[model samples]
Every structure is written in C-alpha cells, then in structure tokens.
Target: SQQGEEDPQALSIQEGENATMNCSYKTSINNLQWYRQNSGRGLVHLILIRSNEREKHSGRLRVTLDTSKKSSSLLITASRAADTASYFCATDAGAGNQFYFGTGTSLTVIP
Candidate 1:
C-alpha cells in the first residue's frame, strides 16, 4: 500500500443505511484522518485518529485504526442523502506536518 490507498472505488446506498470504507497506508503515521467532499468541492474533516488510539466516533461517524496492520476504516451509520460524498483517508507522518490523501471513495446515498 502507498501512503494512502482507499478501498472500493465507488459505492451506492439508500438513505438510513450504513456505508463503510477502508484505507491502507505504507509507512508509520503519527495520525490518520478521514474527510468528506461534496460535488467535487472542498473537503470537510470528519475525524482524526492518532496512532496510539484504536477507535473514535462522532455522531453517526465511527473511525477505527489498527496500527499493527497499518489500516483504518470508517463507518457511517444511518446515512442520509447529505452523506453522499467523496470520502478520503489521510495520513500525517509528523514530517513537516504534511498530510497525504488517499484515492477517495465516491458514495451515493439515494433517498
């Protein structure tokens, strides 16, 4: 895996359902973050998980990190139409404070 490699190129789901995505990284990271973008626009930070942490959640979003495997996953529960967006995982190596983003997963939520 590269610095950021998200699985599932695209996804389609109905409102009220759940959407899950995965990401794998190459080198060790200081922290991992998840972001969302709508309509090919700017990205919104969703959650951030430090290498020392295992899992974190905010509202309907849950993020998990497995440093041993160098992987992470994001789960959106009770997904809404507004949840339809591109999801990306980013890694921060703590080197110059730069973040590298993944390929991204396009999610479509039908209402």
Candidate 2:
C-alpha cells in the first residue's frame, strides 16, 4: 500500500480564492513535499517541509507538517485561474531514498 493519501478527491474554486488540501501518511516520514500538475503536463515541485520543520511558505503556497500526527496540509492563497491543477503530496520515510505519493487532489480555479 502507498504511504500517503490525500483528502478531498477534487476541488473547484473561483479565481482570487484560497485552496487547502490535506495529506495523511501511515508511517514516520523524514520529509514531505507538495507538487502541482496541470492537466496533461508534468508535475512541478511547490514546497518541501522536513520533519523538523513545522511550517513553510513559498509565495502563495503554505505547507504545514505534523510529524506526531503523520499528517500535512498545503494552502494556496489568492489562487488564480492558472492555478487550476492537480496537487499531490509525497512522503519520504528515509527508506532507500524513495518517495511515495498521495493519490492527489484535483483543483479547478475558474476565472
């Protein structure tokens, strides 16, 4: 079974709105990362939060990690129509330097 799974299968929002997504994992992890994928395109790394870090922000993206709870969240503020994309969470458990990914959350930002 995969280590991580994201909540909310899909989401729709208007431009200028905010979008939030969550991810849960089964075991201890060394780090967590979020990526954005536009339809029919490769993914782009958005943010990465290490186990020692509680939160991090890059531009409009905010990521929070709770190692104790084995959970993490990604928040995007002031989303734009171009922000419409599928988001995925990846977890690294320090096992062979491999990372497992969540199913993903599809976000649609309407103009």
Give all TM-scores, in the order shown.
Answer: 0.95, 0.95
**lDDT for position 14 in model 2:** 93
Give me the runs in candidate 2 sitting further than 4 Å from their true place.
none
Q: What's the CA error at residue 6 for candidate 1, in Å?
A: 0.7
- Least well predicted 10-residue stretch by lDDT in candidate 1: 91-100
lDDT of 1 by residue, 1-111 (tens): 346989888999999999999999988999999999998599999999999999999999999999999999999999999899999999988573788899999999999
Structure candidate 1, residue pairs in collision? none
Relative to the true structure, candidate 1 has a C-alpha RMSD (angstroms) of 1.3
lDDT of 2: 0.91
Q: How accurate is candidate 1 locally (lDDT)?
A: 0.92
- Minimum summed lDDT over a 10-residue window in model 2 is located at 91-100
Off by over 4 Å in 1: 94-96
